[model samples]
Target: MNFNKIAAITITGTVLTSTGATLAQTTYEGDEFMGYASTGEAVVVTSISGYFYGDYSEYRDFTYTIGNDYIEGTALCAGGGTKWIAEGYGEYEAQSEATLNMVRFVCEYEGELQ
Candidate 1:
């Protein structure tokens, strides 16, 4: 093939790859939360603090969109005092003014203390 054709193909491939990566996942850090969003699911880490058992603990919220509906929940971690890591899952209800109703979700999470 000609050099021009090869260059065009290379550029097209690069653009496609970058676009797919961008759509697959995104992450953010804010004053109150750190979060990441994937194709159908999102995770928000809202709080991290010292706990009785270990140096730190983590609390997270999550959301997953399904069609026109969505599911949301929270997760908490209670450190093992020495291992510095923990895992837990829970369900909760959230109020959305737009929907004028309550939504419930189940969440599972794991974290390590810094």
Candidate 2:
């Protein structure tokens, strides 16, 4: 019987046991993390529009017009629902010789905010 062989076998078994213990602990921690994430707020898709008429993920027929005082717009949302009456503002850089501007808007469903 070789002492070296016995020592090597013992060491291998110890390493494998330690690795298994670590893996079990990590798995438990991962499950706990997933449970916490699931409880948080999530966006639910209320409905899908343009199911058969068109692509449900694409917005179409969007139109906007700018006036001196206000900006008005309307669009067919991907869910097939119509989104209109978006309110937004524009930022202009007067110092820049080139045209530089940005517009941002928030749309309400059915033109109403709940």
Candidate 3:
């Protein structure tokens, strides 16, 4: 094969490979059901905490959107008597069918984390 033709073919294959990897990391396909809540089911709280088995735990806040309806809440994890925070979005096609699509999550930490 000529040098130019071989180079072009290598580049095309690299591009396709990278594109597939990107999609695989960002795609989700599965069914995971976790209970359900009725409308107008909410409570006021000063703070929230949960038990997570780890030395470090992150608190994630999730935001879901479906047409005109949307839901937003915090994802909490407690460990080492302290809370860490990490933020990201969710991508699950089946979840969109059940309720709103979880678009994103953002978290902020206050005080010093132990």
Top candidate, metric TM-score: 3
Local accuracy of candidate 2 as per-residue lDDT tens digits, 1-114: 212211111211332232111111000000001011122322121211111121223232222322222233333334323233243633222222111111111111212113
**Where in model 2 is the C-alpha error above 4 Å?**
1-54, 61-76, 85-114
Which residue pairs clash in candidate 1?
A: 53-81
Candidate 3 local lDDT, 1-114, one digit each (tens): 112211111211332232211111111222223223233222221232222222344444434333334444444433221222222433222232132211111123222222
**How far off is residue 48 in model 1, in Å?**
14
| Predictions in order: lDDT | 0.26, 0.21, 0.27
For residue 14, model 2's alpha carbon misses the true position, in angstroms, by: 68
Question: How does each model score on TM-score?
Answer: 0.21, 0.18, 0.23
- Ranked candidates, highest TM-score first: 3, 1, 2
Predicted structure 1: lDDT: 0.26
Error of 1 at 40 (Å): 16
Write the residue-wise lDDT of candidate 1 on 4-109 in tens digits. Answer: 2111112113322322111111122222222233233233333322212122343334343323434443334333211111223343323232111111111122
Worst 10 residues of 3 by lDDT: 19-28
